[model samples]
Target: MLGLRPPPTAAAEYTLGSPRHPDVRVRVHWPTAQRPTPAETGGLPVLIYFYGGAWTLAGIDWLGWDRLFRERAVDAGVIVIAVDYSHAPEVQFPAQPEQGWTVLEWAHGAARELGGDLDRLAIGGASSGGNLAAAVALMNRDRHQRPIRLQLLEAPALDLTLGHVDAGGVNKAIPDVILRQMAARLVTQYLGTGRGLRRHPYASPMLARSHAGLPPAVVWTAELDPLRGDGEAYVTTLTRAGVPAVGVRMIGQTHTSGGLRSVVPAAEHLHRDVVSTCVPSTHRRWTIRIRCAPRTTGYEPA
Candidate 1:
């Protein structure tokens, strides 16, 4: 349970079961709207959501994020499918990535049954989940399979290299040694072999040989996050590959704020921005815009 509390919002009824992959389990969160008849849902898009927890702790029910995600999907007139990829230390290395891809594959066929448009699909996640989202997008591209229309990465940890601190100008409060140790543990566990740190595109999107032909991307970065540099570098890489990308830097926030979207207006706005970016012209063209408040005693932009 991770000692986390349940979301305050009313959750829709759904089911949890093994996906085709015996090792991977999926938790589907249905939208609150009445299920559409087959005739009524000929082309509704779906958003596949991945949750962030440093690729270890946390689950589908942490905070009210899932509820909010479903709400956003309903409001955007899309179906919301959340995947529960196996975590690290037990499942390790490429498991989450593989599980993520597997879930995406399932969503394509499953969306129709759930009354969604498989052709207009999108993927999104936060932090570690964001890392998975980017990786999966690359896999979809490299394999010459599945067309992803959009990608939403919120404060993604795109770089596995140890020297990102100097490049990103991370906050001084995060101890350098501790950061390295955590990264080392993650690499060792996730790859199952230390060789996972070799910077494979499947493991690290930053290492991908090409970002070309990938879908339009919406990347969110926190002004106070240690992973800020990786997100910026990713945006640059995407642009170089000619992929339409938008990067938004949230001021006065940290990586953890994403999980608290229910309580934070800024986080809520960030979620809305991601959904707005994914959906087709339902309204005005959505662009990543930065807003800042005057710095006070303890707040400053990175």
Candidate 2:
């Protein structure tokens, strides 16, 4: 349902792997400061990102990722590499995770080529893309790949089984039953016959047997989203496992609403804060101390 649009801003495109089960196409976004070479400032920080589409739709043109590409690069002075993983109905579950893994592995090993510092690599995404980001971190930890310094999950669908949803907190526009039905379709399309079979932790990360050793993360959730339960639950799991994890429940909003900066003030806060947290301030290139300045408890704006 998304149209093919050339990146509306300046970015370098590259093809990674093949077009089969796990091949991917990626774009590397750079801050427009000095146009420094790949290893600027002894290598700039890298943000490995995935776009949200419920493992079925969306690409770089999605409002969230596209906006980040157009505005954040210059302000943040960081490099963002977005992965275009193959969607479902044509591919399947493991394919998406495998593609995510391939991109992570390459990013971890080839940071210098992208004008990035391996030491500051972070991963993030919106919606299903958020799920994939968490899965990639899990895979990285399991595979002993370079540690992911931070993870940013926005309205992530962390649990595919989704038994934790109460639907009491969701918005009227997105009813609980309808959301559940959509989730069922997503899982069915991605897992196929595997629904009756085994559900891998990598596929449904919250279902993972453990959450220890995962990187610190900022889990952003919309108050009215069914996946809010999943993101909140994941934060608890990670925190209990000794990972420094924080959860932000965006009140009076639904899933992916934080990306709508033009309409919502809180959404702008979320979008800007996310981009800021992803990159180091020009003054402090090697140090990062992020503290949440939440507005208020309930729906009060910041």
Candidate 3:
């Protein structure tokens, strides 16, 4: 057990098991309501989030993510659970997805105890975390474990095979070659001795046998991002498979733009869109979708 820890106003570091069941750690952010609880929900809608870092602890020591999470919880009036999952290389591919699935299962079973509605569960993540979220959705779909409401994938690293990063365009952010190299090294480390696992659905959801029956997806991609093509393609696949999916490509932004909300307008808009998309509508159903033409093949403009 950890002795000294941060305060729990925005997020409380919660443990799933105390040397009983397999131990799992997470940071859960509970919302603030006017009354004792919201009317529509006897409990709060839970948004399980995974931070971006190629499955690594990127900013665990930093306070930025915690602040944004807290603000989003208050604004959206939902329980925000940010997972501090183990990193790759050390733990490898299957372990990452396996632990994520474990967290989702634990959250669903413990939702009521934590004052979160089991029926209103949503999952979201950024970058590599986004990839894991997508994998979890697909896992749930195949296993029929739980019904997920929405999947918010922000600049997800979907195609782990490494060739998809070379979009053959210049936008002034990280170059295609560097991005490709990074992906190659990361994939090598993640797969370790199991190189063929790259094509596995849990490792790369974009390479899934079918995109049918998965949860509705809200895909956020950056125009300059290397993974933009894969992210948008996943949206197209979902749409064609009859799932109501929307892909938003933020112009003049990079892969990690979702984390720069305070400085960039596009980033801030993405942040607001996430909060609004997860939160209940005051008037009618709220969504970030726009009417796309029949032949449109790319992302919807943001």
Candidate 4:
């Protein structure tokens, strides 16, 4: 359960759809202050966010994610558009990423009307949502050249194969073997019976043969999360491929630690780090300084 609060700014709701796909519900949360018109001043950056729920739970209306979106819109001074993508075991794999790409296409076409900066657009998500965000980034690269400036992944589940999961790194409340089994089931449920679907770049971004030509990314990983290795390996792969990427390992944090911001002080710090990352920086340089000791990393422009 989460405490409900009034949204920090005005939000507009709409539905986006294509003939082949189901209609996707979208909610756009505006920052408290915005330029009167896009003609006078380029509008605020837009962050198209997806909520995490292992691909089965959570929606744009989930109280936890709603609060995060509102906070990000107000604090980062951007237009936050949350996508309620179709869930798994029903919609499955490529459908979710397809829906995500549809939103990106709409944003590009309607940026001016929505008072958003086309060039400063970004996408982000947590857990399974992160998988979709990365998948969408790959789709943008392979399908069309969308001006997506960044991909912000928090506690992302990048490798659906579950090969990179280190159950021992997860919280010990549940046994490592059990955690491994649970993870396997989630992956199986989302992937369904499709053969070799686990290796599909849209289903598992880390399995993509090439990480080059994708937008710059800011990846956040919890030290105690079983998926931490997935995030670490992804950052390494992206960097080696000559993409601008940075990873921050939050020390002593777990997979669900992000939802503990109300009690855990460090969680608030993570929020600030994310909000700062959302802001459009001059020179197109993006950097995240790890506040936690012995585990911090950053990107400095050359």
Q: Which structure is stronger by lDDT: 1 or 3?
A: 3
User: In candidate 3, residue 101 scores what lDDT?
Assistant: 84
Candidate 3: segments with Cα more than 4 A from true spot: 1-10, 17-22, 33-41, 59-61, 169-176, 281-302
lDDT of 1 by residue, 90-123 (tens): 7765767878887787777677777666667888
Please, what is the TM-score per model?
Answer: 0.81, 0.86, 0.83, 0.90
Better lDDT candidate (1, 2): 2
On TM-score, the leading prediction is: 4
**Order by lDDT, highest first:** 4, 2, 3, 1
Provide the lDDT at 4 for model 3: 26
Candidate 3 per-residue lDDT, tens place, 48-90, comes to 8877887655744346667666766876788878877667667
Two-way TM-score contest, 1 vs 4, winner: 4
Residue-wise C-alpha lDDT for candidate 4, range 122-186, written one tens digit per residue: 99999998999999999999999898888999989998888888776665788877887898888
Return the top candidate by lDDT.
Answer: 4
* Residue 118 lDDT, candidate 1, scale 0-100: 62
TM-score computed on alpha carbons, candidate 3: 0.83
> What residue pairs clash in candidate 4, if any at all?
none
Error of 2 at 194 (Å): 2.7
Prediction-by-prediction clash tally: 3, 1, 0, 0
Give stretches of model 2 more than 4 Å off.
1-9, 18-20, 33-35, 171-175, 196-198, 281-302
Off by over 4 Å in 4: 1-6, 33-41, 283-302
For all candidates in order, the CA lDDT equals 0.69, 0.76, 0.74, 0.83
Which candidate, 1 or 2, would have the higher TM-score against the true structure?
A: 2
